[model samples]
Target: MNNLDLQKLLDEMTLEEKIDQLLQLAPAFFEGANSAGQITGPLEGLDLAVENVRRTGSVLGVGGAEEAIHIQEAYLRHNRLNIPLLMMADVVHGYRTIFPVPLAMGSSWDVELVRQAAAIAAKEAAVAGIHVTFSPMADLTRDPRWGRVMESTGEDPWLNGQFARAFVRGYQGEGIANEPYKIAACIKHFAAYGAAEGGRDYNTVDMSEWMRREFYMPSYRAALEEGCEMVMTSFNTVDGIPATGNRRLMRELLRKEWGFDGVLISDWGAVKEMIAHGVAEDEKECALKAIEAGVDIEMMSSCYPHHLQELIASGAVDVQLVNEAVMRILQLKHKLGLFENPHRYADSVAEREILLNEQHLAAAHEAALKSSVLLKNERNVLPLAKDAKVALIGPFATSDDLLGPWSCMGKREEAVTLAAGMLGVADPNTVTAIGCGVEHIPDEELAAMVEAANSAEVVVLALGEDSEMSGEAGCRANIQLPDRQLELVKRVRALGKPLVAVLFNGRPLDLHGVLDEADAVLEAWYPGTRGGAAIAELLYGEANPSGRLTMSFPHSVGQVSVYYNAFNTGRPKDDPNAQVRYVSQYLDIPNEPMLPFGYGLSYSSFRYGEAALSSPLIRAEEKLLLTVTVTNVGERAGSETVQLYVRDIAGETVRPMRELKAFRKIMLEAGETKEIEFEINEPMLRYHHADLSYKSDPGKFEAMVGPNSKEVQALSFELV
Candidate 1:
């Protein structure tokens, strides 16, 4: 419909009709739509009439083309104007052909690959009649205790911002405004939801504005700048105001300063959560605050439909607010071509033909392979010989749970297991396998594992959290390997057998025990469907592992929030001349992460030459050129992630010891060398100052090039 047509419809809509456009619910409230989305609670609490639900503009968490057609048909039958229901779901990783989780995607350091994975997801979901996906979460996570870290791109704001844009491009595909086989992208949990105190999900988030702008806000803005069509407000409060009701954050900043005119949405039940937050007295007040604060749609809640009309009639809010929100909602619907054909996405033929095809599965396998980070390879223990007798033992050894959590539409039975992958790649006579539960390793299970190891030349212990243990609401106070698993690792280490620990976890794990006991460690994060095949390929030398760590592995649970980029303290532990007694070093352990960010091992070794700079001073208009020659000194061909980090020697406020400004993942042949160049511009050097103003202070800066954050060769330059 044209703008005039949409406006006329808005003018004709009754107060109930207008509120219906702002209401979003699961399938239970609407007839014929199945339970594809989670139900927050019963619909009885909503007190919404059946007619109101029938007229609701959108449906959440409902999947399948047939189901979608049924929903749209049911709604149109009851509606006076024949409006179609917009279908949205939490298609975070994949709809049917699952890919690696977002954190795993970050480890690949390949934006194009990540984009392709998202595009594949969109294609699969679109055929199933999905129109919008709450995806590419874009939250910069520092703590692994939060289970939702699986949905994020990981620690660094710069990298998260890059992945955010990639997800947006992949999902919205060169402007989804009119594109088919695509869906609108929603960059979610706006404004620092990942910084929840103590790493608890939905917990209080208290942070300085300087820290928020400098570290947490970049990715959200980046996704928005990439034309992300929707924004989902975070659950926690920001600056003493819930983001859903904060006029300063949503209106003054997001809308006025950032110019985000796209549809803004509240996370599931976040609107009524204001009462739990003690910010709103009742539902009426909550409706008033959210609309005024710029929320266009309320998800899984009755705040808008139940109380909006009363609030409007009471003059607590202007009717123009509701009109603007309805217009935005209608505009998005029109953009999706909903008015043109309510059943545009309901294509059962395409659904049966396009989903989980061989091509899509191959791409998923490729993504899973690249996303697996080889965290440790001691004494060249990895790349196991295909002829050597290998023992695979763990709960995941034969289980198809490799699809991981939030794999909304992937079928578990279709997933390949380690045993199947081994049989496919290795000599059947050389592979022995047994299923030992991840936790509660009984005497019988241990004896069985010992027998399997005794008959094999080497052991590959597949262990990590289950799919149920590390996604939404999967937070853990102790981010370590399960006690039974650690004990089993110790016992296996005592057996004097060569060991390789293949981990399948969602978040960064405290691998202290596994690292000490195992000869090799591979973090195959909830790798989707082809995960088993990818792991087999890497283990058999068919694929070289190059994935890097996007999140730091903590030395201990006490180091929960440790990340690579941190403010330099006055009593810095890195000061070589400082005495140990007065330095900022831990007494029991070193002031370092167990596995530092940007760290990953490969079958090949990489050597970096001294950094070369074009000039010592950088002008405002010109970018400084820095080059480093990287060589694959190992015998095998492999890929390496050459990272470039910078440190601001001086600023108005203290600066992080080192910040990741740029990186390039390069593929090289044996003994091949390549000169990688990076351009350092003004924006790269700027940070939020004491007053929250972004600028680069005139001072000497250190540019470092290396394989990871901990070790690097430094070169000094001045930003003048």
Candidate 2:
């Protein structure tokens, strides 16, 4: 059906029905919903009647294919027009076959792998009858204190933008209209939600227009360019106004300037929270502001349903606003072919076969393997011999909490633990012990671990924050391992056994204690369902570690927002002429982070040859080629992520010290050497000036090529 059909359906609806279509509620609110009694507080708190739920525009979540079918069938029976409910869920990383967290996927630096992971997530969710996934959270975060950093790709706008486009393509493969197994992708937390002050969740974001556009807005734009189906407003405020009700941001900028005609949604309860943000007077004012700002759906909020009709009748809101929102909803349904078959892809039989299938699990395993960053490997201590008597001791030794937050339908019980993975390769004498919990260690547990360490040839300490420690609202001030866990590490170190540490976490942590104590450290970021298996492969040399750090790991929490792409101050710390006491330097810690972005290690060592430029200078539209030879100098084959970064000597405004413009991940044999060439055009050197106009200025530039950001070979060039 076209706009005419949607418009006719809108015309047939009474004011009450049209208003109902603007609200999104949980599945439990529907009488025949799978979890009808799953949640009682939300239903009573919102004061929404059963009838209002039946006519609701969308369902927040569904249990499975059976539940989605039941909710739609029940809702359709009560509707005069038989308009189906849009099934939406927060399928962040995975639906059932869980993969690595978004931050981990970013570390892989493999867009195709990230894309494949998303497609698998879409396939699983779509079969369970989920129409839309709140995924590819494109917030470029610098602060690790924000718990939601796990959801974002990283601190680089360019890399985050690349992942955003990949996710959209993966989730909405081809198009939902043609692809029945794909779900619609929603790029979320629009307008710099990741830059919350103090790195606190739901805190105010006060940034200049230039910074927001230059650093934060690129990812959202890239996702829209890829035709993402929807946009979700953040819970924070922009320029002292809440994003859910900011007219200039939603209507003027996103809808008018960018020309995005897709559905606009509010992050949970964000519409009503505008009253708390001191902008709206009450529910009536909240509804008026939200609709005026072009928010099509208010998730888990009663502001629209309770006050929209009254506001429309009082002439405070135009009826056309409601009509447009309803049309967009209908258009989405039409795209998913829901109007023709409301129960599209809700196949119970097929869902069982597709969810957590062998192929999907293999993809998850590969993702975990590539996403795990080898932070420190001393004296070739890793790639432990399979016949060694290993002692795996820590909270996560046998724990099944491998699947991280927002793992919609993934089961922890199904996760392969570290102990289970070690059993497959190690000697029969290998011992396993949970020496401590995330924040505590018992006396008996410590004793068991010590005894195991005494009898073992090697000790592998598996530790990190629990699944509850780092997702939404999982902020930490210290951003370090708990005191008890650190104590456990010290005890294991005293045993004089070869020690290795594996971290299961979401955010980039301060590795002061653990890094010094462990002989080798692997950042196995909350690896999903197959985390244990993949980690085992990396430890046993079955697979080489290739994942890099997308976000920098701070030396201390004092450097909460440290990143590679930062402007150099006038009295730079690295300047030889500048006095050490007078330069912009920290008294206690170094200016640099413990680990820099695009930094990772592999079992196989890599050697970089001097970079050569095809030309010393080039004009506009001319291409400059910088070629470098990379060789694997070790005994084993491995993949290396070659990063290309550029620095502007002078700009209309001071630019970052190094900005990642392009990157390529290539595999090399034990003794193979490959020449990698990058084509640099004029457009690649452009940046936003002080006046906020995006253009490249004629200037001297430096091109750097290396395995990571810090260690690189540079060549000078002039763009005139």
Candidate 3:
């Protein structure tokens, strides 16, 4: 219904009825079987709640396709209002044909693949009778210690924004109002939840507005710009205010500043948690605070239904605010065509037909291939020669640990193991050994695998954390390979064979020993469902590895705050003579990361020529074009990621030594050369001034072009 019609209906309802319309409760019937098993039905019980919603005009959660159809039919039969219930599900990753976690997808830097994965996920979810998916997490994480990092695209704002738009487009697809088997995409953890202190989940975020705007807000903006249907508030407090009750953030910034018109849902039980945050005195206060803050839905909170009416009746909240919230919910339902055909999405045959289709599997394979970062390939030791007798050793070599966390929709039985993939590509005589269980195994099993390694010409040792080690509630005290796994690798290396180590992980790990011992290393990450096939293709020269690291790999877990973009210390430790002084450098290790952000190696090497600027000086309104020529110097065909970075030599405030501005991934045959250019505009140069204005100061700037942050070709430019 339009606003006029909705308001006309509201005029005929009592204040109690109007307040009830703003509240939503999950149906008790078929509650436990919902995706993730976190959903629960209403207070009075399933049947009672259904009857109550029928009379009260509230929403209920329908379990799946069959249940959704039954509930809709029952509501139509019993209700005078005939209001439809909203079916929701946690469709994280793929609904049935699972894809890689968002972090792995971000590493791919392939936006289209990410879109296809989400599109398939939405297709399966919609077929299952889900109206909305809590997905496309746009949180910008810099801390690997945060377990939720698995759910987010890695730390870059620009890359996160691109992925955000792709996911929103994929889920909502053209428009949810018209498209069949499409669900609304909820862009979540609203703002800066990724900046959780100490990398702990649900920790406080303390950052300046400048940092929030520059590093965290872009993805949310992008999601909104792409017409995301809903937004979920984060659990963390921002600047000492819980995000669930922050009126300035939700009302002023999100709705007013950015013009987000979508339904704003609080994170799971976040509305009630406001009491724990000390922002509310009780459930009544929590309801008043959240609704007044512009939140439209309370996911599993129950505070909205229990306390909102009392709060509104007592004049704690305006009646119009309650009406506005109800209007938003009804508008979404109207757009979904729920009133006309509530059971439109309730088809069991479609559910069986759409989930895990062949096209979805192909997309997952392409995503895995693109997301595999070739961290090191010394002596061109990859694309293992055909018919070569290779030894596959490691706990992960035969294990189904390839499916990373948040892949509940993925089945382990169907997952292809590294051993299986390699055997499929290699000759019949390919040797294999399980050096250690990816998680846990007996010492005897480790010894046997190491013995088998002695007979092979080359060994491929897959290592790193299992699927459960790097997701939500999976925070680690030490970000390194388990001691047992490391020891196993050492024993396997004693066999005197060239070894290639493949890492299957969610976050960056401290792998200094493997770096030194292995002839080559590939940070495959948790490559998702077709991970094995993708790794095998890259290993046997069927595919070229082009992915770059989105996060820095620390030398040790102690280097917790490590990143490529960090402000230079006042006492810079550049000199060898100053190494002993207590400065930014660690006594035992270098300040540099084990592998800098954007660092990756290919079978072929690329040589970067000197960089050139179109103009030596640029005015406030003018832009400059920075160009450089990169040549493939090695003998094999490969791809190189050309990165453009900028440094402000002088600024009103201190600046990071380098910041990534633009990057391009280029493919080249042996001896091929290409000239790549990046445009530097006013926005690229702008930063928050001391007075809080966003502007570029008239000063000297350095433009650097290179393969990664640590190695770069530099040129000077002036912005006036």
Report the error of model 3 at residue 352, Å: 3.1
Q: Write the per-residue lDDT of candidate 1 for residues 579-662, one digit (tens) a residue.
A: 878987778876789999999999999999888999999987889999999999999999999999999998889888899999
How does candidate 2 fare on TM-score?
Answer: 0.98
Clash totals in order? 1, 0, 3
Give a tens-digit lDDT track for model 3, residues 235-321. Answer: 899778889889999999999988888788887678888887888888888888888899887765567667776777788888788
Off by over 4 Å in 3: 9-64, 71-80, 178-180, 433-436, 575-582
TM-scores for all predictions:
0.98, 0.98, 0.93
| Residue 590 miss distance in model 1 (angstroms) | 1.4
Candidate 1: C-alpha lDDT: 0.88
Clash pairs, model 3 backbone: 27-41, 383-539, 395-436
